[model samples]
Target: MTGKSRAPNLMVFGVLLCLGLLFLVLPAYHAGNLARIMVLAVYAMGYNLLFGYTGLLSLGHAMFFAAGMYGLGLSMTGWGLSPVPAFAVGVGAATLASAIIGFLALRTRGVAFMIVTLMFAQAGYLVILYFGAYTRGDEGFVIQQADRMIAGIDLSGDAARYFTAFILFAVCFLGLAWLVRAPFGRTLIAIRENEERAQMLGYDTTMYKLRAMIVSGAISGAAGAGYALLFGYVGATFATVQYSIFPLLWVLLGGAGTLIGPLVGVFFMFYLIDISSAVTSAYMLIAGLALVLLTLFAPQGFAGELRKRVFAWLP
Candidate 1:
């Protein structure tokens, strides 16, 4: 690859290295926080693949997320499967769900698409509630610490959990960075910019979008599965609309279509709430104000703005 093509890979590696190093210095509390941030960053990155790159707006991603979570949770808790296999099942469930949803929802465009997704997600949430006998309803069941171990390593420990989250984030980050630089990624971008033109160019736009949904859902599902496995709890709350919106906020704030935007947005939002909550009960107000200012000043998002002004080479 040319130097220009190599830049994104180098940047991704550097970010992963820095994240790995940060664990050594971070306090246990902050380390735990970072772990959560990393997991959520994975979710935002998945959202970016569909919304940012493909220009498909989904308001019901929580169903796929919850699919992965409940897939893994129920597998281990009910069927007595191992963590690795359960995680795979969760990702698979998400992939399948996305494929089905994409086929149906992709038929509609714009606001109709968003509404369809939201309706599907709400239906999924209700299903979880209806099957309370297995899902445990709102009061989620906890995965015992003993079941959280992998190959004799205890993931419940601070260092182990942090490193695991870091590894998961790094893999997804680098993979996406590489993907967006690939030909398929370029096609998605083309479709995003102008679907009709892409179709005139002989591209199967619908197929590409369906594929994007599958990939996006798989990644989001992985994040959800990781969160449940690492944190040891899966609940109906994740299936709620708020969880779906969180990824959108992160992607928009970080810079949609930018490789590193998801992580930046997740880190920023997580700390914004963390710091604001300590000061007052009106944390949501503070967050809203911050978001408003960000939208007014940096319409393209934090990383998006930086890419526009400072780093044209940023992937």
Candidate 2:
């Protein structure tokens, strides 16, 4: 924010930009899958904004993600909107949904909060099920784009979509890092550390938590939109609890409060699953077992454990 900090910020941005460009050189198969992993990482970071930093464990982020995917899918397929506007609508819908659900969930805390969010998320999934005819029922809406909606660049192709996702992930990663270092973000951290103390110190803990939820929800939504566009489909499965828990696992495994931890977690878990699949039919079951073992052995998480033992100065 200050002139003295501009150089560091620029350098960080440059590093992120360079990292994004690296994807262009990756093999197509790796690039596409890595891009998807980056999207999931983004979603994890968004969840970390609240759950990790604000100490609010939400089980309903699927609600926001599903909103974004469905919104974009419907906009592009049913409404015939261009990519840009359709994506905007998707993000907006997720924002609206998060705001409404977060407002209600924030009224409770601990397990109560978690339950409320889950209930709302499940309700949203049911709505999608009920309106299956419009949303293509359980099969979902297939998105097909014939026009370039973003600056005349066609993002329908796999390579283009991968690059687009890289750009989004890079921007989000840096932006989220910046946000966590800001004053507002510090206040959220304070709330996480101790809500009573933060409130006593004149900070509006409730308001801060809500703000974090809004931002987190928006990022989650954006990730969802990017996934739908990249994959060219939006299904009700995106809204289910099965999907919601992935981000939680990612954040926890990565070291919930660490900036780049989510990225590491996504990379590790995604590839781990891939590797496990070649050897076993029940890949998820084995992965789950591995996770249980890892969690038990290293309670602080992968990044956290690394920081504690090797990199004491990790951010």
Candidate 3:
């Protein structure tokens, strides 16, 4: 095709994508599903920042996620704070908590680091589970005011919440994209490629790792806040091993190193689960099999494979 023809095609594609997004955000689409997908995408993106960009694998991301949820839950219920400020407080709390955890975990490498993080997350989960009074144990906290107005906008309406989430997702993704292109991001890549060499070159690998963890945690926390608002509840289930593993699956299945890959993976996995749940009582089994097949057959993920095909077609 001529360059002129290609330009129009590209414009049409962009317009279609925007329209599709608008359709997804429509109130008739069901707020629960949209919010679930958006929050999960945000969570997956946070995990991708560390695993994809920094080459650090974490198996305890649920800890940060839970931290955010509980932070928002407690603030709103306990202190009667508004949702927006509560979310901000939750993000700060989660970031600080992750920073401390990352500080200790960064001292180790490889599987040890993964284990330490997992253990920490599990410990957190157990604490919430056992503390029935504070966390309401397994009963969970019902968000009675999830529909409350913030900045003169009611969150109870599906359209409003969907747009709010979409805006937040776009902002976070753009900020992350900018961050990965900055000098600090380059340093992170350097550390990921060769920590020892980076250290020898006078780079502070620990600080870099901690900073990455903080950013990842903060973003994940915000996602958690969104999750709570959408679901109108917070439960111990949010802090499960499954939650942590899901993000890893998203990163791996979407093409870990690419920004769009995780988002693509989120859509694929969520839809897969949605379909599987409709077909069988054992949704986990179906989802697990799908993940295994994707990992084995498409190691570079859907986005990576698509990129290869596109390049081949171009040539």
Candidate with maximal TM-score: 1
Candidate 3 lDDT over residue span 88-179, tens digit each: 88898889889999999999999999999999999999999888788897789888854356887777677776777776677777677668
Clashes of each: 0, 1, 0
lDDT (Cα) of model 1: 0.94
Once fitted onto the true fold, the runs of candidate 2 whose alpha carbons sit more than 4 angstroms away are 1-18, 145-149
**Each model's lDDT:** 0.94, 0.84, 0.81
In model 3, the runs with Cα more than 4 Å from the true position are 1-20, 24-27, 30-32, 308-315
Which candidate would rank higher by lDDT, 1 or 3? 1
Q: What is the number of residue pairs that collide in model 3?
A: 0
TM-score-based ranking: 1, 2, 3
Clashing pairs in 3: none
Question: Model 2: per-residue lDDT, tens digit, 38-154?
Answer: 888888888989888888999999989988888888888777888889889989999999888878889999999988999999999999999988886678867766543477767
Question: What pairs collide in candidate 1?
Answer: none
- Give the true-structure RMSD of model 3: 3.9
TM-score, each model? 0.98, 0.92, 0.89
C-alpha-based local distance difference test score of model 2: 0.84
